[model samples]
Structure formats: C-alpha cells, structure tokens
Target: MSDNFSRPQHTAPLTPILQLVNSAPIVLVAFFAIGLSWWFLLIGVIFLVVGGFGYWASWQRRFFWLNEEGELEARSGILFRRSRQLRISRLQSVDILRPPVARLLGYSSLKIEVAGSGDSRVILSYLSVGKAQELRSEILALAKDERTSTQSAEPADHWKWQVPNGRLVASLVLTTSTYFLIIGAVASVAFALVEPGSGLVTLALAVGGSTISLIAGITSLFNFSVGRNDRGIAISHGLFTTAHYTVSPIRIQAICVVQPIAWRPFGWYQVAINVAGADQSSKKSGPRVLIPVVHEDALPELFHELLPSWNLEIEDEWLASAATSRWRFPWQAARLAVSLTSDLFVVRSGALTRRLSAAPHERIQSIRITQGPWERKLGISSLHADSVPGPVRLRGRGLASSVAVHTALAELDRMFTARKSRKSEQW
Candidate 1:
C-alpha cells in the first residue's frame, strides 16, 4: 500500500450521507411545523435540498495530509478556509469512533487530541473502516518518531478487565438518578390526584428527562472493556457509537476510584482517570472511564498494569480530619482522610459515595492550604493538591492547621524531587 499521505486526501464518498443524516433533526422540525401552515412543507423540502448540497460542498473542500515537517495538517470550510496543524510531539491521544450510522455504512472517524490545545480537537470524519485503522496506526507511529508506512498486525493485548452487559445495565438502573426518578414519579402521581393539570406536566417532565439520561448512560457504557497492548492502555465501549481509545500511561495525571453506597453490597467500583488534554468541563469530553464497573478485588492488578510506576497501596497511617470538623461536615468528617506514599498522594472522602483519589508526585501541579472563617475558628484547615482538570480531585478537608501546613510543605518537596528524577529519565 502506498504511504504517500503527503498528498491531501478527502473523506470517504459516503460522507455526505452521514452529514445529511446529522441534519435530519432540522428537517423533522420543519415537518412538524407543516401542521401550522402548508408553506412549512414546501420550506422543509427546500431546506433538505439546500442542506444536502451544502454537505456535499463541505465534504469536497475538507482535506487532510502530512506536511514536510511531519505534522498532521487539515483544511476545511467552503467560503472561509480553516486550517489546522497537529504537532506529533504534542499528541495526547488518538481515538477511533464509529457511530451507529457510520458503523452501518462501514465507516469510522478519527478523533485526534493534542496537549495544551483547548477546544481544538481535530476530527477526520467518514473514512473507510480499513483506511481509518491504517491512518490511526500511521499517526501513532509518527508520533512515536517511527517512520513506517505498511500497516502492522494488531498487537496481542492481554485483556485485563471487562464489565458484563448485565452488570452495566443494572449499575445504570441502580444509580442515585434512578432513585430520584422513582421519587419524582411517585410524587407526580400523587400530585396529579390532587391537581390534575400541573401534576401531569410534572410527571411528563420527570419521566422524559430521567428516561433520556438512563438511555444515554446505557449506550455510553455498554460493552465496556479495558486491556493492555504494546502502545498503552486500550479502552473500548459504547452501544450505538463504539469508541476505541489508546491512552499512554505517561499522559495520565490522576486516578479516582468511586464506590456508591448502593454498589457497596456488590463490592463494585468505578474507576476514572484524569488525562492531559482531555476537556474536563464538558460532560461529552470529561474524564475517561478506565473501568465502568469492576470488583474491588480486581483493583490491585488493574492499578499495577495501569500505573506501573506508582505504589498503589494505601498507607495505614492516614491524616484524619480534626475533631471540630464535625461542625461543618457532620456525617462526612469521620470518613475524611489523606495519606502520602513514596510515589503517590492520596485523598479519601465522601460518605454515601466513597471516593479515593490518587495522583503521582510528579503530576501534582500545585499544593494549597486553605482556611475559612469557620475553619479558622475551629483550628482546622484544608489541603489540596492541584492537577489537570478531571474526575480525580486531591483534597483533604478538616485537617488541623498545623498538620495541613506541615503536610503541604512535605508534598511540595516530594513533588520537586519526583519531577527532577522524571526529567533525568528518557522517554
């Protein structure tokens, strides 16, 4: 196969179909408006034709290729040309996504993320399955400074963890949201008996929102699996839109393990990670789920494989919250604890949903000690270790002021030492 990606390449011929499908929602609205006026039907027809033509034009203008400097370059837009360049050195992750429609048509998309680039994700859409896979491998190879053109055989990955379809469905159904949904539903029914008009509206809204949330959760987490390959940790999941993510261990900043009260009986936990360059604010691009659901016993092995460099064990001597902290966090103060290992800083908190957040020493961005008016009166302070935005949050509340200060200084020293050592090692 020719490795001549230097020449600009267009998306698959079927891209217009996918684009049109995406625009169908607008057409649907137009159809609904037809009841208001027959002119709406004519308008809908015109919109569909114009949208289809625009999609074709946009598809024709979009192009991607490798430049002389080895950076991935893309250009798109019809009137105002928009150009993007992705430096291989700053590459964070390369993911393959196949939405329901694209999968049905044997097509896929590549989502390329770069470090330190906010909201600048580059997506190469509507590529043939084979072509997308080949391009993905090529990009990964180039990012690693390996000059190769031929497609390599898939690496033999040792499957580490998998979530059963049954467990996944059950987990989604058993969440706090489900509880709220049930309560709202029952309340709405009661209200309807008292005031029929308002009650019906409340019931409809509650059911509609909860149903959508449940369906989205199920679709996103269905068939979740994690494994280790030659490149890095591989995560695959989704029902309608399957996504395969390749995350390098070095890019991981922090890890969080959460166990909801309801899931405690089953000894199930959910693990999420904070990775560099991932959009933390957006739900659609938040922390990557390392494992949607897993038994507690499997955690040691999972951590060992995912974070080979860090010591995963929690130390027995943990810094507990101050006695006076009960004034602020009555129920949770007893559960608040923080610990530091040779290689990791760990924080534990939460009552109903127990959370364990850990970050490697080198990954800690900053250390802060905070004391509010109430905390000051109670002689308590909070310590926080900042990291890249994600699910893993390193914070220990309700610590003795003296203890918080000492721990913060110690952590700063450890962070510097870890960073210095890391700099000495070659990638």
Candidate 2:
C-alpha cells in the first residue's frame, strides 16, 4: 500500500469561475432582498467577481496530496493558516460534480463526504473532469484495499443501468415532488398578480421558493446512471450539475423502492438506500438514490446487483393488496403486503405512492407486533421489524389474522437464529 502514484496537487485552475457560477443565484437573491438598484447591483457584481477570485486564490493554497502517514491532507488559509488530514480508510464517499458551465470550462468539483459530524465534507473545486475521476479512483482504491480502475472503456464484470431520457422526463413529471413544486409556483404567481396585498405577497414569496425545487428536479434527472462492481455501487447523474457518487454495497443497511401514483401505471420505480455513513437529514438533499427510475422488467437483475442476499423473488400473492382489510384502516392498510425470504423481509404498502421496503436479516435489530381494538376483534395485526434510520422501514399492516402474524414472527425469529448460527452465510 505504498503511495507511489502521482496525485493531484491543488484544486483545478478554474476554481474561481466555478465558485462564481454556483454563487450567482445566492448573490442575486441577496441583491433582490437588499433592494439594490441596477447601478448598485453592477458594483456588487464587480465586487463578487473580485471576492470569488480572492476566495479561490486563498483556497487553492491548500494543497491536497498523500502525506507521509498515508492520509489525505490539506494545508490552507492566507492570514490565519489551517491544515486538515483525513484517513484514507475512513473516507465514506468521493463524488465528482460538474455543473454544465463547469463542464464547458473543462472543470468539476470533488466532494469528499465522510461520516460523524454534520456537513463534514472536503471540497476541491475546478478539477478537470479527467483529473477528478483519476483522483477519485486512486483515493477509493486505497480506501477499499484494491487497485485503481483500468484505463479500459468500461469496468469489467459489472452491472450498469442507463436511464433513458424519455424515462427520466416521465419519472420527473409523474413524480409528486415535481408537480408539488409546479403547483406551488403557479399558485404563487396567481396570488402575486391577482391579489396585491402585502400579506399575500409574503405567502407568494414563500411559495415562489418552489421555483428552485422545480429547477433542481429537472437538472437532477439528467443522464442518471447506476452500476455495481466488486468495489462498490456507483451512481452518476445530473445534466446541469452532473455528480458521481460511489458507496460500498456491503454498507447498505436498508432500501425503499417507491412507485408514485402516476408512475405506478407504467411500473416505474425509484430505489433509495441508506448506506452505513450516509446522512439521513433530508431525503431530497442527500445523494442516496440507488436507481432513479427503472421499469419492472429490470428489477430482478437490478435487485441482485444492489442487494444480492435480498434478491428474494416475490410472487404475485405476496404483493397482495389486502382488499378485505380495507374496512380496518381504509386505504392506508388496504394495500398491505408482506413476505419473508431466507435472507430478506419485504413490506409493501401505501395507497397513492406504493412503497416496497426491504431489509436484510443481518441488519434487522428488533421486531414487534401490535393490534388495535378493531384489528384485535378481527383477529388481525401489524408487524414491524425496526432497524437503523434511513429510507427503509419494515412494517406490514392489516395482517389477515393474529395467528398468521405470530407464525410470521416465529418464522422470523427462527430464520434469524439460524442465520446467526451460520453467521458467515448471512447477508
């Protein structure tokens, strides 16, 4: 594990330009808030340019390279100097994000996302795309106890998924999130124009914020790609701001496969996972998307690729919408479905947005069963297998009978006990 390879010395040369491009929206908002006149804004723009360059110049002084102890180190600051070091083995995720403009400028930003403290990320901006990719491969290799990727056209022995443009657009449109923003934006405009009151204007201003979400959703959906190899699972997407995120699949704790109301008809599903070191604060913000959208036909192989142990073929009966239990919990528990395979337990529920949650047995920390008065009277209950936080929740409501629920729980306990006995064989 010698640090023999030549590594990147500093941030890309166009760091200032990339920073300015990313900061433009914030700068504009600040100007609008301050009621800056056109001439004043012009002056502010000049200052912004100068300040961006100054920040970049100061930032680049922090050289990034392998230190003697085999750690990624950075030395920075102009007036009050600062230095930081991150253990190569402790790195959680390495990402390359390229805004459209940055790509045109032949530059991208590298995000080194790690665990523990909130927002503890190391960012290197303006790296040439090739250089960024190279650095990422090298760092990831060192961290994962492997060699860097070959210079071949593609990685060998891997599962790669390409999301078609049509599917991406369809998923984005069909996604409730996209329309929620659009509706908010439309309502904001309507209010601002139709009712000219200060209070209404404030509300409109609040709703106007959805404009950014709409734009982000559109930009985020572009060129989404997912794949898995011996090293880990890799996800790269975005057009306006392309990003490459990689995580070791072994670290994946839970998975949530979602089919929105509109996309359900087409059988389009989005799979999101919670990995060992991922931050779970906001679903939309984090880079936790496993597969943005894929049709049903592709799921068998996709599931195996991402979670091999949990590749439990769910039969149609297991996906049963518990129509008979509709009276118990209305639409909420109407579509309840649950299945347990040797390695994985899956629960599918939700009316408007059909959700399929899967968690490997090794990750299941606890299990519980509950019944309400009416459910008890009906000799039915709900089952829950709780695990660490993320998108995955294993809960099946409206079981057909209490005896069946107990049988399932007993089976779960037996399977878990057997798996524990054969620890090496478990997922």
Candidate 3:
C-alpha cells in the first residue's frame, strides 16, 4: 500500500461486480415477474445488461486523489464528465462505511463531507479495507493541516460512553412504535380468529412493517459507542453495515437532549447534535445521533466531553410563554420557555417528549422573530435561533412580543462577541 494518492487512483477492480451483487434484490424481483409472462423475460434481460454496463462504466470512470493544493478531488461520470474538489479547511467530517457485501469482500467506502454542501457528498467506494483506512487517515491529517506519517501509530481514543446491548434492546422495546406494533399484532390476530381470511392482509402488513423497523433500529445502533481522541470525537456503530465517523467539535452547530414520556421513568435521554455538511434528512440513525441512549446522570459529563468550552447549564431566568399563549399551547404553555446562558441559547418545550435544545453563541447563524396575524392579536411572538440543519431546533414559541424582540437583540450581541473570540482560537 503506497501513501501517495497524489496520482488519480481508480477504486478496486471488483467494484462493478460487487455493485451488481448489491442490486441482487432488484434482479430477483425482475426474475420473479418474468415467471408471470414469458414475454417479460426479454425486459429483465435488457435491464440486467444495461445495469451491468452502467456499473462497469461508472467504476472505470470514477477516480479520486489528493491534489497539490491539499484538496480532495474526485472525477466521475462516463458521458457527463463531472469533477469535484473540496478544500481541506472546509472538511467537516470523514466516515468509513462497510456494507455487508463490502465487509465480506474486504472492502470499504470513504465519505467526505464539507460545510454548506447540503445533501451533496464525495464518496469513494469499494476500496480495499486497509487502503480505505489509510486514505481516511491521510485525509483527516491533511484536513487538520498536519503532516501524514506512516510510522506513527494512530492516536489512542478515550472511550467515554458505550450503550450496553441490553439497554439498547430495552430502549427499542419501550418505544412508541413497538407499543403500536404490539397492538396492531393483537388486533390482527383477533380479526383472523373471527374470520380466517379477513385479517390476513392486515396481519402481514403489520408484521412486515414492524419487522423492518425493528431490524433497522437494531442494525443502526448495534454496538453503539463514542470516544474522543486528539483529532476529534469518534462514533462507531451498526451491525450489517458498520460505520465509523470522526466529527470535529467545532463543526457541531447545536445539540438537543430529548426524553420521551416513557423514558422519563427510567431516566433515559437521547442526545442528538446538528453538524454542518451532514445530511439531516436521513431517516436512519446517522451522524446526527451523538448518543442514542444515556442516563440523566451522565448528561453533564457527556456534554462536557462534546463541548468543553461552552457552559450548557440551564439558567434560572427562563422566560415562559405569555399568558395569551394559553389559547395555543394550552397545557404546555407553562413548560414552554427560553433561556439564555452566558455562552449558550436554550429552548425548552414539549409536553410528552421533553426537548432541551442548546446552541453556542458562536454557532448561532441568525436570530429570527416572527409574529403572525393571530400571534399579533394574542400579543405574542416567536424567536428562532437558526443553526445548521439538524434535529436541534432552538426556538422560543409563544413569547410576549417585547420579550422576543429583546431576546433577539441580546442574542445577536452575544453571537458577535463569541464569534470575535472564536476567530482567535484554533481548531
């Protein structure tokens, strides 16, 4: 294995074949459809031939390398001819993914994300496991403006939090989805008992959906753990498709701690964070999940590990919703509050599932205040502290108009001061 990726390098030669194998489900379905009609066989063959050719062409065309300017550059596409270059300084996170087939074949994929890219990402797929790891390390080192050294052993990571398998299983079982699944199964069984064929479809649907959901949850969170090293925070998880992510602390825009009503009794809380460049639209538990499940007592230590500079303690001077907001929030008006700490802006909301969202002053991209016609009549407004896209939403809803305006201005001042100080600090 050579450390020099300065020259454009093609991925593993087996990439095309592996891609075809990965699409086996679609091929299987096409074969199954052909059984219904002899004429369908022609369509299936054409699809297979076309898809195979496309995969081969894609593999042949795609190439990636580290450019002289210390940027990651990738080129792909057979006909369109696409090229992408990402600056090392803008790199947000690096991830390595090993799907079932790739894992079995000793291959992995490297994903590099940059700030403000939305859903767009640079993916180098089907590289040998060792090569991918080496490439990842090189990229990370380059991103940090450090010299890459092959002789130096990788820095050891301090394991901070690990989710026990039993706890994760318990957490999955206690979810609202699981409860609904159980109810659906019972109803389907009862209906079938009354009329054998009446609930057959319902039973299958309920069982299928629940099975898929359960498997996805298990696969995503299996062996979940978090660690910190000199470079950044590391998150590794997944069963069928293992994923390792290295997230820079400075890339974190906001964080939220959530506690479902059911989880409250057990003192369990889920932590999620907003990171620039990561896809927030992913349905599966992805990079946004800081910690899947943590005890209430562990939150303080966990927060410190993630963002040691920012003081995340909830302040006592929380401004609750205005009296007129009772008409809108009803039972939750009292619980809805927004507070500003010395270094962070916090929003507390939710009746059933309590959410505490906090954004550091330096990460606050913008502050917004809105008053709808109905809100104006109620003499209330809402303030939103916008950050990069993610689950952590810092919003103060149903606040007195005057308070909302005052808070917005105060937050803006804090953000300017924080940004000035932050500029002096190095990553």
lDDT of 1 at 219: 90
Q: What is the C-alpha local distance difference test score of candidate 3?
A: 0.82
Residues 1-427, candidate 2: write the lDDT tens digits: 3354345376766677667776677777767777778866876778687878787778667678867665677767888787777777667778887767788878887887656576466777778888787777777766665234333332333778888987787677667555665566666667768776544555555446545565577688788888775566777788777777676666777788888888878888888776665666655435667888899999887887766766656743474434556778687765687877666778878998888888777777777787788876766777788766677678878786654466466657855675566454321
Candidate no. 2 TM-score: 0.77
TM-score for all models, in order of appearance: 0.88, 0.77, 0.82
Best by lDDT: 1
Q: Order the numbered candidates by TM-score, best leading.
A: 1, 3, 2
- Arrange candidates by lDDT, highest first: which order? 1, 3, 2
The root-mean-square deviation over C-alpha atoms between each candidate and the true structure, in angstroms, is: 3.3, 5.5, 4.3
Instruction: Score residue 186 of candidate 1 by CA lDDT.
Output: 89
Residue pair clashes in candidate 1: none
Candidate with top TM-score is 1
Better of 1 and 3 by lDDT: 1
Compared with the true structure, all predictions reach lDDT values of 0.82, 0.71, 0.82
Which residue pairs clash within candidate 2? 12-126
Superposition TM-score, candidate 3 onto the true structure: 0.82
